[model samples]
Target: MTSHTVQIKLNGSPLSLETSKVAKQADGAVVVRFGGTMVLSTVVAARGPMEGRDFLPLTVEYREKAYAGGKIPGGFFKREGRPDEKETLTCRLIDRPIRPLFPKGFRNEIQVINLVISADNENDPDVLAMVGTSAALSLSGIPFEGPLGAVRVCMVDGKLVVNPTYAQQSTATLEIVMAATEDAVLMVEAGGKEIGEEQMLEALAFGHEQCKQLVRIQKELMTQAAKPRWAFDAKEGLDSGLLEKVRQIATPRVVEALAIHQKQARAEAIAAAFEATWAHLVTVDHVADDAATRVKTQEYFEKVEKTEVRRLIVDKGIRVDGRSVKEVRPIWSEIGYLPRAHGSALFTRGETQALVATTLGTKNDEQKIESFEGDIYRTFMLHYNFPPFSTGEVKRFGTAGRREIGHGALAHRAISAVLPSKEAFPYTIRVVSEILESNGSSSMATVCGASMSLMDAGVPLAAPVAGIAMGLVKEGDKVGILTDIMGTEDHYGDMDFKVAGTEKGITALQMDIKIGGVSVDIMRQALAQAREARIHVLGKMAEAIKAPKATLSEFAPRFVTIKIRPEKIREIIGPGGKVIRGIQEKTGAKIDVEDDGKVTVFSSSAEKAQQTIDIIQDICREAELDRIYLGKVKSIKEFGAFVEIMQGTEGLLHISQIAETRIRAVSDVLTEGDEVLVKVIEIDGNGKIRLSRKQALRDQPALSDKEKLKIVPASAAGA
Candidate 1:
């Protein structure tokens, strides 16, 4: 087939999508390009749905090759390993919006892969890959209900810019990636600097409008190069009779089980109900005990449970936990829970609890991230861990899963806006949140705990940040927006909208719509509710720790920042780093000297840190005239003696200047290795120093008779 291409102007640049010329064997493939960046997106599905599968098995992968950025892999293997955090996040970004658009009950296993073949460094490939995936799925005829579009929007210089360059993004106060259908928004991921709700709404609207144009272009591409859709039944094996029977037997029990307040109890009650229903079907109803039958029975039972849960919220105004729509759960927190930790907090909101700890380190501890753009160092890092025991489950523990990474990234973004600048707080900060118990909104709990831990550690954050997870249950005209939603609500609800920020505004937000999409009005209402919940959480957090601690913990490392001339960096480092190493060895401190003459010392003992700083300052100090120093005599000559003053500085003390009366030889008054008081009499243009011992003695005050009597004469002391 001949290639078909379509192009459109987006964010002051032309974006083009082409298909039919590459990866023809795949169900559908599209190569998308903007500026000099190009990404190839391909979608392939199994010939038929997997038997006994009740859900869509979809996988999305995004990879960037080192060659794309004109570089090679750095490791010994010289090849790419598993997906990094950015790639994993981009994969999620492409999957979240498209997964909801597939036909219901389409259990086919589908894989969507995006490869960044070329990168220009100016434009980001993630959004392009997203748009390409949509186009590929649209052309693949895989029963997808989308020609959706995605766009990145940022507020630069108080103006909303669509797909701003990386430089502009660095300075942007608000940045968001929004995905939407023609009628509504499907997904949103955003981070801001305490931007208000109104401004966020405006930015969302602006991004949505741009997405419509992208959607239009994808449609235009499909019209030119569309292929015949494959024939697949969405509800091939769905038994209506069995579904009704299961619903009749399970609905009442499901409702009763939902009334349980505790998560484990509710789960056990639901499981018992399901077992009883199955037993009744097998014995009384004489149903077959087959794998397909069992799978269908469980599927219908879950469907009934989902329906009842939604009805209880939307129709009856009763949530599973029996809370009102806008009510939050009970919140309690403790600071400094771990005495040995630099900073720690135990934050509990109802059933969800997090034990967060903050560790402070010097520049050596900063994380170095290698990406296509360049290597960058991060001084602040947040990690989230969700062990199986948090939910009372027994499972193998290993590396963090995609869910963990995504949740951690969201929480990291939320709290990062409030962290102090590196210059103000010159210590590397690491916040780790261990989920001790979870019922729902554990990630948001992490956000709250991270804030408290940072304050407890004396991080001097700009403001306290808090996060809340809101759920939406909508049926036609009736809609319910649940605040601080639990696990069941999140599972059965139409939207999971998380908002995090301070009392002033939002710092981060993430929304995923499981239904068709949500309107602007719904989004606005959800944001307002989330803001209220966030503020409530913040208030509870303030009860534990209102602001950063004035002093760090005794166990925490002390930091001292010293600035010197750029040229003095070499002096601090000394020859082959011997001087700096010696200072560190003597003081037991860590010193980091930057090219711009920024020196940071880290030590557990404040005295040691101060000693290290003094050493560095002396090494970088210049000799000042008339200043007196206890100089060490290096050598004695007939003409003069070389006296060492300050670190690494030598001054010439002439024989005549060594005594009040002229001396014939310098050794008479100043012998080698003698400690004598000396004054900096002159400093020449070339940094040579001249010292005077006579002037230093003459400047001293007259001694009292008693003090004079205490001084022993040299001849008598020798005898």
Candidate 2:
């Protein structure tokens, strides 16, 4: 086997691409390496399109092997099962940018697989997979739009770093993955700490410049490794004559249907028009086979729908919902929707609705992520669920799909920017968004609802976040930018730009351009329009709950944290967790002890939490020289009475110290189960405590040494 390697200096680091040594049977394959991390990417495409496939049947999979990080698989099966969340998310990171680069009319089944073969824990594999996938596709004979570059840019301490290390990303204020060609940026996924628009724009520009350099390297590799292009039939055939016939019969009704403001009614009207036109064509025009006519009619009607929607928006400045360009739909929200949840809200915008619920838990509740990098815990999580009924359809429901994961991650990024630091909040948070009805950007609605639900749950968020989905339509010279686009506009438009942020600045932004490329000027306008919509939505959310409640709900668990010496952690935990377990069992509270000696107690009752704290304090308490205690008499002895000061702590109350008299016996003044005040006079070297009731009883010093000598004990005088 012959090996070809391409090496270049990328952002102060060596980037290497090698191929022709492995996976030779695949259409295209390459291995990319940076630092010690490596990823193998391969692209495979079917020879011909599926029988009825109308869209690009492309799938991207990113998998991380346990051995990549030199670790054994952890589960019972001892092998990887389904893709974890990180793998799923990385798939999206690669798919979004590359999917748009495919030719529009090519529909052959294509699959791109990326595997992290090695991980050094410092460098990340996701970006490597992206660049490798692009190179593989470019080298393949498939008719792909050549050479796109992907880069991860981060701002650390006011300095921009391209492809930063994982450690640096943890401290960076802005992290974004941008994909672009030499001329324009095709995709972006970003999350920032309330970074301003201009700063974010600058970061994008920096990333794009880096992408240009990588693109150059890929182009050079393609020159040496490129294969002959394969020819395939167009996925969709436009029959002009038949299309015109359907348009003539359906244009009037399509126009009427587009004018209706109600989504369902308009959908019904459009369906009826399509049915009527199909019936006329089959019966009156003598259209042939049953299956052939069905396919032809559906295809023709969709084209007609696309043309009408785009023309109406770009030329007539009309939307199917009767809103003008840059106009947002009506929005309403309510908090405290579910009393049982820690926090809950229902946010509705036009026909889109989300019922979001937030739950707060202790450290034990954090999601454990065992990945190639290492085991890590996530404190904040947002999950989005899209039931088929939300779209007025009936279908089998199973695990979350790519769309659901992508949307949830987007919402998670948006809301996470405003979440309090782990040190400040000290609780694990989970937000679940259930889409009850969806016509347009339900993901954006989830963002708004998540923010409201968090605030309602008494989470002290930095600020409220809102999201808006924008769309674009361009015909010749006429161009229109839309705000708060619905499902119809999104499906027919050329751009789906989602902007999420606070009133001050953007936190998360994702854009995917379906067309070749969009100018920066168009993006600027879209961002400005989306900002307006976001502000309007935030204002509506503010009316529901301006701030987080001052206190957690009565039903929510109460948390109390305490700090002790690190060395004492084992003491509280005891030899076999006996001490801590006993405390939990006795106080009815859950306790989590950390290595740093930080103990957090969680309980439904505040009193129980406090009681657990008291128990812990007693367990860790030390005897002071001059402190007083209200101890109980555990037993009566000849020399003194054994008094229990605190749990497991006992002191000797000598007969002479029991009172200011010569007591005949120790039981004369004290009995078992009797409570008495005493002072800790001394603690021996062996940790034995000596208590003095006589010293505690004396409020004033004896008159003087002589006066004390003159004084007589009551028992002695009586004898």
Candidate 3:
């Protein structure tokens, strides 16, 4: 077997790329290793474009094998099932930046597969997956627009760290994944702790710098390991006469239809105009057949619409919704709409509507992520659901698709930055955003609704966050920036930039463009405009509920946290969890004990929570001298009676110390079923407790008038 390897030093670590040694039959394949993590990325394209294909059919899949982390798959199937959320998001991460790099009008069926074959449990392979996919595609014979690189940047302890390990990411205030060429950034996905725009820009620059090194490395590898170019005939464009005819017929009609503010009405008008033009073209004597005519006319009409939309935006600065370039749609928000939910909010922006609800739960409710990175518990989760009814369509219902996962992740990143620390808010939080209506920027609406709902649940967020989607239409030198863009602009525009942040700074931002790349200055301007719109949306949200509610809902569970010595964790848990289970059963509380000895108790009643805490405390607490306990009598004997003072603690009460006066027998004064107050008179060398009921009563202070009156019988008090 022939083997070729190239090694480079990146971020103080050695990265090795090997090809011609694995998956040799594939069109192009490479295995990349960083630290101890390894990923195999392979790319293949069909010999020629499929018939009737008008768009690039590209699919990217990222899978994690349980054995990569020295574990086994979980669930009834005991093997890998459908793609999880992380995997789905990773697929998007690989697809977004590379999708634009393919040649224009290239309709080949291309597939890229990334597999995590090995994991170090510290460094994640997702970033490496992107770089490897790029390398594989660069080596393929298919016509790709050259190679780019991806990198992960993190801000740790007031300093920027490139390619940080999982441990460092846990403490980093900012995390960003950037895809770029040597000069310009093509894609960015980031979440920050209210980081200012300048800082975010700096991070992007840092990431891009790292990407340059990787891009150079890829170039070197490509020089030695490139395949011969494939042969395929490019599809021909429409004839000039046909294009001119369609333009002349549809331009004026499309212009008038786009000016209508109502979505459904405008849609019908545009469809009617296109259908009329199509009918005219089909009736031409040169048209060969009905099916062929329909296809040609449909494609031509799309081109016409694209031309008209760009002209309207870049020349007239007019949007389909009739809003100005920078104007945001109308917004209305309300919280506490669901009485049973811990927090709930409904937010509507123009035509998009999101009903978001937040549910508070104990630690047991946290979502467990079992992956090659090891087990992780997610305490804050945001789920996005898009029903067919949201878009006024009739479609088959199924689980969350790739779009839902990606949108939910964006919203999660935007809101997670402002959430309070676990120590401040102990309840596990889950936010679900249901799209009731969608036209433009429903994901941004989800972000707004989630923020309002989180606050409604009394989650002391650092600041309220809002999101806005920005669009760009470029014609020649003139460029128009559309804020709060709708679905039509997103389809025909050059860029779809979604910016989310608080008033202080940005928390998250995701950008994907259909063009080659966007200039940095344009990105800066977009950020500034998005900030203004975000503040405006926040104002509307504040009117609904200015801040998080002062208190949690009455139905929500109350949580209390306490710290204990690590050594005592086992003692509290007992053998086979006997002691902890007993405490839960007795007090009706949910208990979560961490390895670090931080015990959190959750209960509907604050009183029960405190009671559970007391039980755990007694189990772990050391016996103290001179302290008294209301203990249970355990036995009757001639010499003394033994009393159970605390959980698993016993003290001997001698007959002589049973009461203030002499007693004939221990049974007369203290029976096994009776309760009595006893003082810890002494603790012996063996940790045994010595109790005295007489001394406990003797040391008790005399009751005052108020205390004495409380003991009066009801009949005597009334008389």
User: Which numbered prediction scores highest in lDDT against the true structure?
Assistant: 1
Tell me the tens digit of each residue's lDDT in model 3 across 1-719: 77777878766889888888899878889999999999999999987676676679999999988788888887898998888888899999999999988876777899999999999988889999999999999888788875888889999999888888888898999999988988678888999989888888888888888898888888888888889877654445546677778888778888888778888888889999987887766676354447755676667778888888888788888777778899999998889899999999999999999999999999999999886656789999999999999988899789989999999999999999999988889889999999999998989999999999999999999889899999998877899999999988999998999989999998889988777777878888888888899999999999998888889999899989999999889878889999889888988899999999999999999999999998888878887899977777777789998887877678899888876679888866555656677889999998888898777766775522233321233244346
In TM-score terms, which candidate is top?
A: 1
lDDT of 1 by residue, 1-719 (tens): 67999999877899999999999998999999999999999999998788877778999999998999999898899999999999999999999999999888888899999999999888889999999999999999888988999999999999999988888888999999989999999999999999999999999999999999999999998888888887767677778888888988898899899999888899999999999999989988878888879888999999999998899889988888889899999999999999999999999999999999999998989999887667889998999999999999999899999999999999999999998888888999999999999989999999999999999999999999999999999999999999999999999899999999999999999999999898888888998888888888888998899999999999989988888999988877889999888998999999989888888899999899998988888878888899988777877777898988877778999887876666677655656666677899999999899998778766764522233322233344346
TM-score for each of the candidates: 0.91, 0.90, 0.90
True-structure RMSD for candidate 1: 3.9
How would you encode candidate 2's per-residue C-alpha lDDT over 668-707 as one tens digit per residue? Answer: 6666777776789999998999999777656324522333
- Model 3 misses residue 22 by how many Å? 1.0
Off by over 4 Å in 3: 237-244, 284-286, 562-574, 595-597, 614-630, 635-642, 652-672, 676-682, 690-719
Model 1 TM-score, 2 decimals: 0.91
Error of 2 at 232 (Å): 3.1
RMSD to truth, every model = 3.9, 5.4, 4.5
What C-alpha lDDT, on a 0 to 100 scale, does residue 409 get in candidate 1?
A: 98
Write the number of the candidate with greater lDDT, choosing between 2 and 3: 2
What lDDT score is found at residue 7 in candidate 3? Answer: 79
Q: Give the least accurate 10-residue stretch of model 2, judged by summed lDDT.
A: 703-712
